[model samples]
Target: MSEPREQRAARFKAALMKSGARSDTSLYEHLVRLLSRVREEQPQDPVDVLEEMSRELKRGALQQDRGALRDVPATTPGQWLAEQQRALFSHARDEDEDDLVETPLPNLAEVAFFFQQAGVGLGGEEMQKVSLALRQLSDARPLRSCRFWGKVLGTEANYLVAECREAEPPGGAGGEGPGEGGDEDAAKMIVPPSTYKAPPVVPAEERGTGTNSSAYFVCREPGLPWTRLPDVVPAHITAARRIRKLFTGRLDAPVTSYPPFPGAEAEYLRAQIARISSGTQVSPLGFYHLQEEDEEEDEDEEQGTTRGRVEENPDFEPLPVTAMSKSLSAWVHHVPHILTQGRCVWVNPAEKPAAEPDEDEEEEEEPDEPEREEGPALFTPLSEDAEMDRLPPWSSRLSSALVPRFAVAYVRSNLWPGAHAYARGRKFQNVYIGWGVKSDAAFSPALPPDPQREFPGGPEVTEEADPTPQEERALRAAAEDKDETEDETEEDEDTE
Candidate 1:
């Protein structure tokens, strides 16, 4: 089976020459270095040494190629969507600056300035893009009112939210184009479908400050056309509370989990925005004095002229900025507390019986349970100074805690982390730039390994130590005894 040494040497020389098509100088040098290293160390297995060298070369090659690992340019609005955004802010043909019609879009520039003052806002670059993108959005759609809601950080990309009130409802005619359609049409399909189904009926929401008052639009970057989110229902809110998920920044991404979310990422974002706004939206003490709206309108109705309908507070005043921040009581929840059923309207603030029914009249009782729904009234005192924890749900302090005059009253909401507001004299600004998650009392997130306490554990085998040989023998003996008993029973049956 032995071949001549000259013949083997000739085969090796031929293989080396053809390694890179034609004579390869790099391969020859690499082989020479490898052979020299192996010859000096005297490796027991040259084959294993060759494999190790190949792996090392691969790793080194990957590390050396800096071009492959270069950073991607961040998404920006400067280059894209420029024309439409400018057209909305200015008339194309007109030269005069006076004709520059103002847009109802919130002055995010000023908002950004306020954020800078409070030390909680986006950077200059992101703010500029966000501002530009917002203009484009306002131009693209018909909005009753539009404002920068907040930025929600996702895993792959962050979402810029635009809180808007539609001048017309989504189901109305002429809702086409990007950002035009408020519901189903706004979604971007990552994957195409052969079949489709109609969107679910969205519950009609009444105006006034509440959870569902405004619709939310999201985009990965400012220049991108906004995708309008679906109106979140109570069920979505209830289920969202049961789990925590990091967004993947795609419109049609499915939320595959327990207590099953009814729709895609859009619906999940809608639910989260609703939940976040309900809890964190706040104002300085006495910033809003709610008066009973349309108090005398329903005179002809069954419930006759009521005592000014105990709804919006008629009169409220403040002492001063320094005095307000001295204690936490000065601050109040400007937004209404969301009921467990997800209604944000301040109905039944406390459990007091409505007017006593007549002797002939029976009590209008709910069939489900006896007690009426109850919650704290709107603008209820936040919490007292004493009994306050190291980290209270809300903490109030002046820009200069003791000094007055130039001090701005800053109140930070620890419950939602990034929610903050500062009141200087009458001027106040509220900004929330966060992951759009509600901070719980617990530190870690609700995840698998240690599942949430609310949900029951799934079926799983309990881990146990391995049995000894003697224990195994005993188990086998028990099995044999059972088999013998069964055989004896069968034999007795045969005899019978």
Candidate 2:
């Protein structure tokens, strides 16, 4: 039999006290107090939570060491020296690990902005260089450009060394040429044009002049590495239309903007957005500062009268990105997927009713039953209700969750490292609201690309004039005399 209600309540109270909760009076009062305490304890936000977890895991790993290794005896001097070296190496590695306790995680909005900056040059020269490097690596050929390795590989140590032979003359006997089965050989050796076609160059004067500039091709064909649409159908137009609706006029706006709703609708949406963004069921409603009533209004109305009192706006104060709107929250969760998902579809409920036999047809069918086949059934059809039930809910079909998994995989395989590196190098300011460190540097807008400008972040190489033979000889004689004088001065100083 189940325990009595009073006994259960007492047990629960005792459990709470055991778990570091304080009780002042009755169990009911204790529960209310415990709930209030839990509500007050809002730990770090999602970004900081990830950072804290990472730090704790690292610290735990570092704390765990083999005590037995310390007690092990070395049989020879060389072995002892080797053991000492290993210990030193381990100590150095531990020292190199970062202490994340003092460092705070970056703001989500700043991270979004950094990603936006990285995606800007996807169809530019940077992408072309990356594509070229990919082709070389796939073909097991030596990379021709050191700059490519630096930009794409992050460091020279990451570059793979390959031994490739030089191609023979085109006209030589048994040599490949355009007319002599060279086309087939070329096709085998080179990357497909559809996979790596460079974006067309637009002249500065002609750019943003017409609709032609607006058109962009995400993929050459509608299949894997692009869209999951059938070969006969065009996916680009459908994908573009859905994506336009998904984002609308929201991407360019800051998260602080209030939802265009009054009263309860705004409050409900805000609460939902907050819950989804933080991945938590319960959160504080946030603090509100009540405004004082006007003296004239107070005088007009009797004391304790609410007649002629103005109602305060529920959403007058601005909220952070985490508590903004559902659209923004969904975007944060699925940014990488959103960028690559070529097409999306929303399933509409069927309007037409299931077909029923007519009166005459029913009468005719009753006249005689057809002979049943003896073999096993090839296929079975589901009932109308069952089929309908199997379909996903309308909400799940929204762009947020409808993005194909393949698109995300493609992005991770192709674009992740470069984008990550780019974002990692830049500074993330305003980490916690308008708080944290203040920088002295003035912000300057990035300039549009110009061919005449020097290569970015690279030193200019200038050719120096060569010295004549007479000048070279004179310089050598001066260097020798200077060395001799320095030696004599050193000898004099020693004597003194």
* Tens digit of per-residue lDDT, candidate 1, span 179-298: 223655545646666344442232323432355667788888766678878666655676688777778888788997665676778878887888777666666567676545475556
Note the Cα lDDT for every prediction shown.
Answer: 0.66, 0.27
Local error of candidate 1 at residue 232 (angstroms): 1.2
The TM-score that candidate 1 achieves is 0.56
Model 2 scores a TM of 0.13
Using all chains and alpha carbons, the TM-scores for the candidates as numbered come to 0.56, 0.13
Top-TM-score structure, candidate number: 1
Candidate 1, pairs of clashing residues: none
